[model samples]
Target chain A: MCDSCGCDLASNNHSHDTDSRIIEVHQSLLAANDAMAARNKAHFEAMGAVAINMISSPGSGKTTLLEKTIERLKKKIRIGVIEGDIETDRDAQRIRAKGVPVIQLTTGGACHLDAAQVHKGIHLLEKEPGGARLDLLFIENVGNLVCPATFDLGEHQRVVLVSVPEGPDKPAKYPKAFISSQIFLITKTDLLPYFDFPVTEARREALHLNPRLQVMALSATSGEGFEAWISYLEGLTGKTRKDNFPPLLSQS
Target chain B: MHEMSLVQALLTQLTSLAAEHDKKKVITVTLTIGPLSGVVIDSFQFGFDILSAESNLTKGARLIITSPTVSYHCVRCGSIQTAAMRPDHCPECSETLLIAEGGDAIILNQVEME
Candidate 1:
């Protein structure tokens, strides 16, 4: 201690000055991230896109749901996707095949995608055709229920998905995602007859955590309870049903 | 993990702090992680311990974390209750329309350097 910077080592004999100074910083560690998120939100609104952040456990059918949604509304609403994963361009590839602009943000090992990452993602997506102008943007967050719940990626809405195989205890177990989200969509309801996932208990638990959450159940494979979802999207975008879509899009 | 990202953010802040303060080394860092902040304390500490050792300025810096309780005010009765854990039902009126208030912050309170 005495050799490094000429500091006293246990000097108590009438010290002339107290060198220790305490600085009070009442600033948040997340302030930087939040600031970036605010910028991203402004950028999204400027682009006239309603961004939705999707959170769920791994294999909760986020990709499948996106595929179905793109199939239904690709002709009407111009959709763009930003896929966040620990490692993969796979989800982005799927969305790209649907003829919509898509970007992948691989977090390497991080469990979540923050605003900074999305800020970069948006810039990258703009390079693709039709990416510059989007009616709706879907940010598929990394497949983790816990960590991804913490960060906000400047989304207009947050939708938490739960598959039938994930069980009804998800809401009770992962309260942070449900509590923070505005919408909770129960996916893979086609398998409800096989699994013992009680819709009532799941809805009740989520409601207990967040009474304001709008809950919906749908089966993407069976096409059951899909009208509500389709209507919700149409209502969100204020897009009236057109007379006809030009016999378009033979899926690749 | 999310904690690793947070640790990375902390290290970034520390590096800038050391440069700004013209310090050779950091002695201590104080942080406030809220209960509902979605950060696991042990994981964050583990990340900090490992990551901090990699840097010269913060190789031996001590980390102190504090979690403040969140207050919930009932919309029905307007009674406020403070709890680290979410209340199952409102203590005063048994109402479920309780809004969260404060304590949702992850802050770097202070950094001591020399």
Candidate 2:
């Protein structure tokens, strides 16, 4: 039924009920997720956490990088994690083993973690030990590169990782991840000798698509070119590391 | 798929809109899907066709989708170019770096319900 429009010319008083009227609704379909993401950002900022959302293909060494980063920054920065996976709490368990608060978010059959799920994860994380206070909070998104890039999880920065073995064609194929990400991390550089991955081409293509992307390469296993990564992390929190290590960013 | 979730959100919004307008049935729905929105148009239409049929309020509703052109601001020449697809280079200055503006939207524009 439509709102009654007075038109005495119409003999039938109920004519409006049969007419289909168009209603203007200029609203984004992601309004719900974005609103929740804003709230999640506020929550993270209130807790003094620099949140980073990590996106990459499975086996891109996301958890490995995190494990190493936790070991390196735990003493200097109060770190926490929120691990997202399609199933199982395996990644969360690994992060928790490092003696820091970590929350596991299983998306069941869903391909990506939405803002509503991350909102719940944030509240659940605060219930864990030392979760309420942190300098950096890492939200390890689902391993799929495509779907995760479409959703925002209320992180301050978005980091997209592509391992050396995954090849450098990733940027060209999955442009959304590279275009949407702030920092692009090239992982598993230790295997560069064995793999024919042209690291420079990868960085070039990503930069061509997104000129502002900060690209860095490192191997979490060998710690080669890892200091820059750590310094980048420290710079995010802006001189908040408790270790008070001299800033290594001037050289980076 | 994220498309399914998005279709679900659309359906929910449609239901609320119908209730708000005191309408019994939805006739048509219009939406805008941007090229860089990361949403596959086919998957979204498939999801809408399947999910909307399950709800009485939106059953048999016709879905119309339009893709709006995006303006890519050339980083070199500072010229803005609008296109349905992301261009490889700036047409004016021949620069490869162009920051895309708009065209990342997935919005519900209009609906007819009675």
Candidate 3:
């Protein structure tokens, strides 16, 4: 037997048949998506925008959080949104009502938004009024925890959110989402009294999955524990509380 | 499942490989799916079984899949352990916060054609 190619034919007497051969091609299946994601990252940087990808299950208050965030930061920062959904432009419509440049990407039944879809969404968003230049871009991924965590959309940061009603076991049940995300936001905290969710246990589980995860719990409705989230956004945009308002006393 | 999408990608890759090498049929395709790749092996195989039948080039193609073990490093003791699933705690230090490394790739290793 031929030892080189592990063929049944003898090495010295085997015919040089190109018909049969083994090709060694070691490459990642997600390489194409990753390359496009890199290009999307460069495009975002070129526009001087910090893009964030938000992942969560449906009804996790992702849209509500964004609405409140835009209300708070629109005066100081230019915000845009790319909303992904399996069907329906409702989320985009809601974001548009906030007076920001927002585009809706209907995935056509796909569970997750890949980098290519986000690239198209970026171009469409740029065509909208006040979209050409922005300080931040929020890509609201299709509301599914398992699939979105597998695809990179060229975002600067990834945030995985779970609502108090969704329970604290999300991190344990969906390990990939928690493991890949940099931030874990527990939304709808005002329902704590009505729900049995334990914030500490949720944070601890998420931290166990990813030690570097920044976990924060907030209620957009009650405005509870929201200051930290706003400050974190300001930090990402390289702005401070003073930047949004005049200094109390001038240094000069 | 996204495994169907990945299977479609694999079929595309196989079609191109056949054209590039002037082969008539694909005999075997080998893949290495890591424990943390977020891909279900059974789903991927089911996808392959259904999709590969649509084309003559990849029909009856044998798929060989191997999953690599993930390595977890103890945060307290710095000891490393490899397992197919996440270990409950560090064997050396009883620490529960072990950091995982690698084992998150879906790689197309090799293809045999005739």
Candidate 4:
């Protein structure tokens, strides 16, 4: 108990009224969000799914990559997707057409999706036909590199994408995304021949910032470097491929 | 902007805290934004400024932000450097491979209410 104020302030008796009426809160503003994220994590684990949050700028081929990934792995892997956007259900429409359990979270105007929003989204997705069961859950975060890095949506893996048009300087410019993410994906790599994107430089820069970052470059249209990505997903789900496909080595 | 959502969250927390404490006015709010915490300080302040004006309790309330620096330890020589911004390279060994430690938090440290 607080001695001076008779307030039930736990653990300590330090009073705000004593010194300029300043209170020592020592609490986080994100406490609510963190609690929600923990609940979301438990929910994901209950469904036995590995949740992956994909972050990137707008038009970084996140939606397209999901479409292609679904086409390739939908039969073997049970996949679910949560598409987050500032507005509209357009991305959700795209994912739903691929015949996977999908949910759309419109942030209205926020550039990032927080744990609370994703918590609500998870409950909503469970209402869909195939949402209850999942092998892999893809959380398509709001298409922004900066603000989204600050919020954790209870994802087991975080993949950050940058298209060739966005250039190689992304890792340097937006250090938070690269630093926080476990994987760095160079999307729209088919345009590399025409663009001035130096893949080596991009990888070097990203690795310089975060040595543990697993980097890959792929093109959804041409299917270039998609095998490595597929293998990565398979590895995460603990699925082993019996087919003797040529292995794509990691980029140095 | 995401700042708006963050501001909204802050407001919700503040209002709830005020209600719990039976406080009428908020005097100050102290937030600690880490150097690597992806929130833009200016934008967050701008957001607080705009949204805090909406409520009488929060109106004219002062917001104080403290950004803590993370220590980057050089993988080569094990030298430590504290910086608000990421350094280009290690000053001691000039090595480019340096790992950042801590400073990735966006916390509301304290609030003054009465």
The most accurate candidate by lDDT is 3
For residues B35-91, what per-residue lDDT tens digits would candidate 4 score against the true structure? 777777899999999999999989999999998889998889999999977788999
- Per-residue lDDT tens digits for candidate 3, residues A1-252, read 886667787674653665778899998888878999999999998888999999999999999999888888888899999999999999999999989999999999888999999999999999999998999999999999888998999999999999999999999889989889999999999999999998999998988878879999999888888888988999999978654542212211
> B1-114 in candidate 2: lDDT tens per residue?
789999998998998988899988999999999988889999999999999999888889999999989998999889999987778899888999888888889999999888
Residue-level lDDT of model 1, residues A106-200, one tens digit each, is: 99988889999999999999998999998899999999999888888899999999999999999889878988899999999999999999999
lDDT, ranked from best to worst: 3, 2, 4, 1
TM (chain A) per model: 0.89, 0.89, 0.91, 0.88
- Give the top-scoring candidate (DockQ): 2
DockQ score for model 1: 0.62
After superposing candidate 4 on the true structure, give the runs of residues whose Cα lies further than 4 Å from its correct spot.
Answer: A1-20, A244-252
Docking class of 3: medium
Q: Which clashing pairs does model 4 show? A: none
Q: What TM-score describes the B chain of model 4?
A: 0.89
Q: Which ten residues in a row are the worst by lDDT in model 1 chain A?
A: A243-252
TM-score against truth, every candidate? 0.90, 0.92, 0.92, 0.90
Better of 3 and 4 by DockQ: 3
Clashes of each: 0, 0, 0, 0
